[model samples]
Target: MEAGGWAAAYARLCREGGAEPQQSVVQQLRARAGAGLDLAARSLSRDTCGALGRLLRDAAPFPALALADCMLGDDGAKLLLHGLCSNTTVKSLDLKGNNLQAVGAEALGKLLQQNKSIQSLVLEWNSLGVWEEGFSLFCQGLSANRSLQRLDLRNNQINHEGAGELAAALKGNSSLQELDLRWNNVGLLGGRALLNCLHSNRTLRRLELAGNNVPSDILKAVEQAMDHNQDRQSILAENQSRTHVLSKEVLSLKEEKAKQFLNLMDTIDRQREEITRSSRQSSARVGQLQEALAERHSIVNSLKAKLQMAEAALALSEQKVHDLGELLSTAKQEQATMAERQAKDLQQQKQEAADREMKLLRDLSAANEKNLLLRNQVDELERRGKAQQDQLFQLKQDLTTTVADLRLRAVQAEERLDMEKRRFKQGLDDVESLRQKEVDHMTQHMEASERSMQERMQRLEAVRIGLEETGAESGQSCSACGTRPGGGGVNQSPEPGQAGGATAAGAPGGEATADDAVTRGGPGPLLAAEAGSRGGAGQGQPAEPAGGESSAAGGGAAAGPEQQGAGEGGRGEQGTRGAAGAGWAPAGRADSSGRAAGENCSPGAADESAVQQPPRGPAGQGGGDGRSPGEATDQGSRDLPDEGGGGTARQLPSERHSGLRAGVPAGHPQPQEVTRPRHLSLRRCYRTG
Candidate 1:
């Protein structure tokens, strides 16, 4: 049954199938146990076992239930014993092999303390004492079973220490008679502890220690009881048997002695026959005298007793008369005193009665006056209340109408506010979306520029290598270019507008990409070392040349007048480094820009304000710098008066600019009158300062 079905199952569970209510198995068990089944053996695994425990728990006289082989385990032990704690009649229990562990033992120990009728318990083959806790609990459980006479803890895990503890329990358990601790690992030490229990246990009459390897001294002690009590037992038994045998022997000897005496008596009687006749006459005379004397003594005793009784009656009569006279004198004296007090009491009572009557009349008169005043005040209040009621009625009607109007106005205002809020929310979402798109665009453009510059640098380095190799292979001029400028192509003299206008499309007269670098002859070989950041060039092994090309070129290119051998500032190369159109400028500049941008976004400064942008349009978005200063001034002067909730009455920009219109000519229509109904119309987008 489920936990929630306790009520329904209570009736149905106890009824067996196909049986009348009175004759059901549960009913018959209840009849035997009186009102409720006592011995219950419950097994969830099997019906018979479950019924046993349940029947025991429900029975009235409580059950000496045997729950062996039930396999109910610890939980079932708990359920069965939890019910038994309230039961009073159960005196014995056997929980032989239900797998009750330490926890189960502790639980049963607690129940045992509260149960009173349980007197014997068997936990054989259970895992008691397998753990310290279980052993301690089993010992403690003994304290509650003060009436327990037998405790069989056979085949348990009671070792030396546990056996010692059990022995100690026996010391306090005065009612326990038999204990079965067989088949445990109770070694020599444990057996000795049991022997110690036997030394003090007086109630134990029977013991089974056959399988136990007890010490010879302990066994001898059991045999030695005869030395202490043998005499008393033997004496009591022998005395009865000896008395019967002696009585028979004495009867036979007395019969033989009697026969001999009878013969002797016959001779003596013949001799004494004459004397017997003489003694009879004397005996008769003496009997008459003795009888007379006895009668005289009896009469004397009767006279003495009668005289003594008469004297006692005379003394009692005198005592009675004297007491009566004394009582009569006391009564008369008391009567005189009582009469004098009674007169004084009568006078006092009359005076009090008159005083009470006067006070009552005074109280009554005051009560009547108060009642009349109260009635007059009540009538005055009634008139005033009626007038106040009329005024209150008019006030109530006015309040009801005012409340209805206020409720309608509040609802209308709330609806308008909600519409304005939704518009502001949409504007905020649009603005946020635009900002995100702008950030993504900037990021993509930066990445594209960096990738292009890196590719261009790699190409420039490859071309430079090819030209140097061709120069070396040809042994006269670079095959890639086939020749140099040969001192210059059109060395125009000092043309003021024409400076070193180097184009990026040729490197020392060859191909180039977007980035171009130019350098005039300089000292120290003008080493404008550029690092590669992509592909095999990222290996960045400086482009070396065979036959000491760098050193050979350095001798004069390094010393040839360090800058542009020019006089004017028209060095048209934008970022002129030492390399002549080598395409390294864009790569270096792009790399630096990327580095700076990455640093800006590093976990350093807290502010991202450097990246934020202001809107430039009527929608209040985009990067706006086109609005003239004067236009802003005009708009500020034309704005409607600020309202409390940050929202002003929606106004067209032209309509608000009336002062500007007034200053203009009349023929040109005023913007205030000519509504543009566009960006000119007021857009209510509010921002916090």
Candidate 2:
């Protein structure tokens, strides 16, 4: 039937039963006392049954469905059972006294097998077991149904055969807790089968077999088995509850232990990190101590070598003194013998003189003529001495004039050397200044490049973020609008190439600027300029002898005018010899100046220069007018500072004005002191570079 016709019929049925026909089926079901729909003892046609089945299948709110005494036979029962097969809401079904036969019983059995919500089924006053095949099928459905806990089959006219089938079904049925088969024709055979099934059936707690014509003994045994099953079920339920509580406690304890273990692991990790840090620090300290100890050992070894040299020198000096003492003793003995011989000879000559005095009177006239000739020879020698004295006076005046002229030339040379030194120092200062500017520019360029790179990275990051946001927005729009496959309303985000091009456009200028700065002469040009200045300074200065001559001139400043003039004349001669040597020693001078420039360019040069002041003082003093060039160089080498007692020789400048002042004696003037500030300025320039 159509749905409207069934709904109209249902309304008419509700009105006839004195229920409010204005309410819908669901409302009436919910408003009823048991939330059930009852059409019991009513004339329900096939159309009504279908309507009810449809309601049940569509998940109606009915918890109880009653079609008792409604005269719904096999077909009506099948219709109702069809809907209940898929129904989940109905927990109780009443289909008693409907004259249902084998067909209806089979349909009901199918309903029980499919419907999981129905816990109670009432089939009382039905002829369900009249057909063995139908009753057997119903038993089969009961064996599979797990939701039905109570089954009512009272007065269904079931005989021993049907009872045996039910007993067989009960052997596997674990859900049915109660079974009512009262007013049946069950005999000894059916009772015995039920009794045997109790051994395997654990969920069936109640079974009624009264008025079934069963034997008393079999009935009593079945009763006893049912009681035993109930008690066993109660005990199992209690044990399961206790086990659940214990499992909960174990889970909580496991969680707490895991948390504690994690905390301990964290603490150990922190302690291990601290230990590693301390060990690293200790290793570094040990390295420093080892270096210091090595330096001390080197100093001790050098001191031992010096001591050995001193001991050897002492032995040699002692041997020389012994040899001289022996020679003196031999000479003293020879002198005594010579004095004794002379005394003997004088006595013999006196005896001979006494004989000569007797003959002297006779020879007196001849001796007077010889004395007159000796007086004439003395007068000629006195005249020659006067002429030689006049010639010596004239030569002295000419020597004095030559000394004055040489002194004047020496002063002019000194002034020219001073001018060249000033020019060289100025050039070094300019080069240092230019180098400083280049370094500053490079630093600025690097900073600018770094900033530009950071900005570009930030821009790329922003573009990426924008792309992500655009993608997210596009996805949301697509899902919300359900756009067609070929739709073109949304615009796509810009590509990476376009964004990269924009960022790349501003980058080349900074790179080009950096490249230009490097090409314009970075540190390389600065070093070259410094070398050129050093070379020029070396070329402008006079040779090694000039340094000695200048010191002599300084010393001469303290003497009387005539003595100073004589000293200046000696200085001029020495200066001429230095000029001749300078012509041949240009290469050596260039090498020395280059070495000095290298030292000044080094990072530790300032510290070394400060530490080696004492050694330089002696070197400057050793380069005086009294020393030869070879001797001066040797003295400078001997005075060179030894680092950590290791004799690493270095050639430092010997004419440092500060060293000169320290080395000069108390009476001597420091003519080179005026150039000290210029040297200090040049050092400052090197340090800045």
Candidate 3:
């Protein structure tokens, strides 16, 4: 079947794609170059394996093939790997960008373990979501394949866990010098794991993770690790230098020791004095030993020097690589910042462009709208450019002021809130002062009330005493019955202005006038004196006990002139005030002045004053009106006597209640001010010695 099958295999190869080898025939020619055959970049989106690989296997197999980005995926890759395993071809392979998930990876991994020809592999962009398990399997393949030097799985989504597994593989894999898994969505944690692997893995020189959200702190840590890496390199150099110096010193010492041994041999011969004959022999032996020492020293030194040079070059290369890695990371960070800034600008520009269009649409009519739109587009572009220029300047100023003001406000608010809290606490601490204020106000009110009540009582007492004395003095002179006043039956009555006499209770045809309502006693002393001269009996209090006449006199005494006098005086004054306020001041004597005032006078002022503290008694009674004829006398006897009364009944907790009712201090609506200063002025905190 070799010759016949070859013909058939060649037929499929040509019919499918190998017929046109004009453009990329180098791949086909390489497959038939005798040393080895190869065909790559087949770009066969369909199944090109049976056509190509079968033909190659029939004639000769390739030692290398790179089918990168050829869309082989799992099925195609598996078929090729299985066929190639039997073919004894394909030393180096590149299956990059084939959508080879776990299926293709498994086939390739198995083939790699068994196949010895393959030394390098690039499986970049293979969709291996197999994760850590997939990496482990790949590592297993690497362990089995002794010839493999480089393996690239770059741009694969193998995360931190997978990276860790790869790191462990790199530790044992001595042959692989380059392993790139760059841009594989190796997030910060994954990137860190890979970087850690680099520390102990001397063979791996290149690693990359250009796009990732690596934290600044984590990057700093990596930088520190890098610095440690550099330190380790320096320590290694020093150690090598010390070794070199030790080697040189050892060589010289060995030479010196050899010379000493020869001299010792010579000295022994001379001490014997018999080896004079063997001196040339000793010299020749010494010469041979010297030559051997020189050769050994030269060889050892040459090897040491070469090793040192290699080490130095390796160190230099590693330094450069390290520098490049750092630069790459820095560049990546800078690039990300620049991209973000640019994105913001682009968004703003787009918005500006949209606004400009809207304005043009508003300005133009439908007929010319289209033409206007084009002009608007150009104008918008120009506007955007100008705005962009202005944006930088405006943003600089706004940001400066905004940041400064915000910082100042925050600090000032903090200070103000703190001060307010302290003040509130101090106010709360002064509770005793508040209580004392309430007590003092209560005391002042009580003292003033007591003085007013006492003055009224004293006047009433004097009137009563006068009534009793007059009863004693009258003693039944000019007798008439003790009849009720205004009864129209008895004809007994006092003369006009008579102070000592009293009208009987039932005096004939004598009616109480409006003025008589307030007359509880005789006329006042001054008015009575004037009246007494006009009448007789002389209005005076007498000290005697008598009969009917005396009883009538007793009535006058009880009516103690001053009582009527006080009530009349109050009424007269009230009338006077009412008259004055009503502009009735002495009719024609400067009456015009009074007339003007009456217009401006306040009405009901006289009534207001006359109505005593609580309000005057109602027309018939006192209690209902909350005031009595005298000092709020209670008709129902609800009031206590106006005596000590348990020393004012502990100031009537109700009075305190009344005072509090005036205004109880509750939580206040505080007006708070927050100040923000442009500058923060902190005083130096000095420590007193």
Candidate 4:
């Protein structure tokens, strides 16, 4: 068909219409060399398609071929698929609009690798791209083409790597039914590698990725791989007619007797499940040996009841070992009769221990003469109790040196009673500054006797208004001026210890009234007994022998008492206690001082004669002498009633002369001084100023 008679009628019209070549008959069979070819719509050029591909490689197997729209380039598509590779008769081949570049798609992939009688192949609008090493050698010659069924690769700008090497040559081409790949760029990864080669392609029923940019779920995964390869070719045509049309040697002897009767019924159901699991493990070891033979028959009836309670405790330990061998033969005959009554009580305890050791050697020689007369009567009662404890330690060191000289005379009688209370508060502040300068000189003589009694009642109210204007000539000077203020004011009531006793009893004029001057006995009679009666009337005294010589000179100026008859009976009771503590008075002078203490014998009989006086001795322990006859009867009953209460006798004679010079002034101290040293007696400070 190399241009000899219209190219042999265009290769017998493309092998009698198994049709392909059109375009002006592949440009007149690419300018003439074509044994059996049809150049469809031909406008051939490229050297007339390389001389019609060397006349189909010196043409012999020329069954069908076509070079469509042949403006063929790339050396006329590598000289027409290299003359259809070792053409075993071109089975309908066609190159449409052949601009087949990559060496004409690698010479149509080595003409489908040694042309196994090319089954219908057509490369349309061929650029053959798959990054063109000739479309991966045309997918390895369409996977070693077994007799390639129809493939078209239309619009071959074949992309997704030439549609993944033509989807791996349609998964190793099992005679590809038909793969068109229309409009080129087989996108979505070459339409998912052609839907995974038609998912185990039974025989690619006709997968033609239409219009290239392939997606539609990869064309519904190639139509579910063509309905699963048409349900595996309708189950291989119902297992090839289910062997009933059998006779492949009687269907291989009925499939080997149905596989040896299903392998002997699966070895008789695994030996009947291993004989029902060895009869449930031999009925669980025969119920664990019947519960260990009922726990060894309850441990042989509890060891035959503990072997009959150990044979009744070995017959009560053989009758307590024959009653302890008859109490060890009656304790060896009571230890041989207590060793013959302990050898006759050891010969009567050795003759009563040698007559009780000679009556304990005559009672230990009368208890060693009564223990040496009780150690000489305990050394004569500890030497008469150590000489009566050295006479009570020299009578407690003479009563602690008379209580430290009566605490130094009670701290010098509390510093002479705080210096006689600061000299009786400076003699009552100098008798309240001489009674406030005699009450401001009696308030300026009662404001000059109230301005001279308001100018003598305004001159007796102007002489009774001039005696009622000299009526009856002044009525005798208004009755002698109202009896001259009631007899020149003898009224004197207000001395109840006077602090102006109610303004001297409201004295406009006066008249005695303070209980009649406290029954008339104080104020003027005892200034320290009138200085001891003017010192016994200046020695010429006879006032009862100067009051018994001023009570024996105040008991010889008593540093302590000598008791001159209790200081002459406390100076005869000191005038009713100086008129009741100088509330004062002048009425009968306390009944003449109670008759001078009933004739000087009553101050409790001079305090019972100074308490029967007779105690001075140690040479009268004189610290300034004299007074211990009970301190001369307590200093004549304490300075005769506090010096007869002159202004309460200036605080009871400095508290009874500091309790007769501290013989007792320790007022509240002793709980019990050695069994009562009479309140730990002190004495001696009578220094009054």
Name the candidate that leads on TM-score: 2
Better of 2 and 4 by lDDT: 2
Tell me model 2's lDDT, rounded to 2 decimals: 0.53
Candidate 1 lDDT over residue span 551-650, tens digit each: 1111110011111101011112122111111111111111101111011111211100011012212111101111122222223223332221111112
TM-score of 4: 0.20
Per model, how many backbone clashes are there? 22, 0, 21, 34
Please report, in order, the local distance difference test score of every candidate based on alpha carbons.
0.45, 0.53, 0.46, 0.48
Cα deviation at 681, candidate 4, in Å, is 21
Model 4 C-alpha RMSD to native: 34.9
Identify the leading candidate in terms of lDDT: 2
What's the residue-level lDDT of 618 in candidate 4? 20
Give RMSD (Å) of candidate 2 vs. truth. Answer: 64.0
What C-alpha lDDT does candidate 3 achieve relative to the native structure?
0.46
- lDDT digits (tens) for residues 435-516 of candidate 2: 6665555445445534544454344334333433333343344345443221221112122231100000011111110100
lDDT of 2 at 363: 76
* Per-residue lDDT of candidate 3, residues 1-689 (tens digit): 33334445555565676453232434355334544433345566334554555554532545677688777767767767776665555667888888888777677668767766667788887766455555568667765666666787777777767766766766666556556666666677766776676667554444444554555665565556556655666677799999999999999999999999999999887877866667868998998999999899989988998999999999999999999999999999999999999999999999999999888777766648777888899899999989997998899999999999999999999999999989887765664465355446535644563454345434534543444343322323212323222211111222223332222111122221111111111211111111111111223322121211222312211121111101110111122222111101110111111111111112212111010113222111111212213433323112221111110101121111111000001232211111111121010000100
Model 4, 284-399: lDDT tens per residue? 99999999999999999999999999999999999999999999999999999999999999999999999999999999999999999999999999999999999999999999
Q: Estimate the Cα RMSD of every predicted model relative to the unseen true structure.
A: 44.2, 64.0, 40.3, 34.9
**Model 3 CA deviation exceeding 4 Å by range:** 1-41, 45-47, 50-61, 86-91, 130-135, 214-689
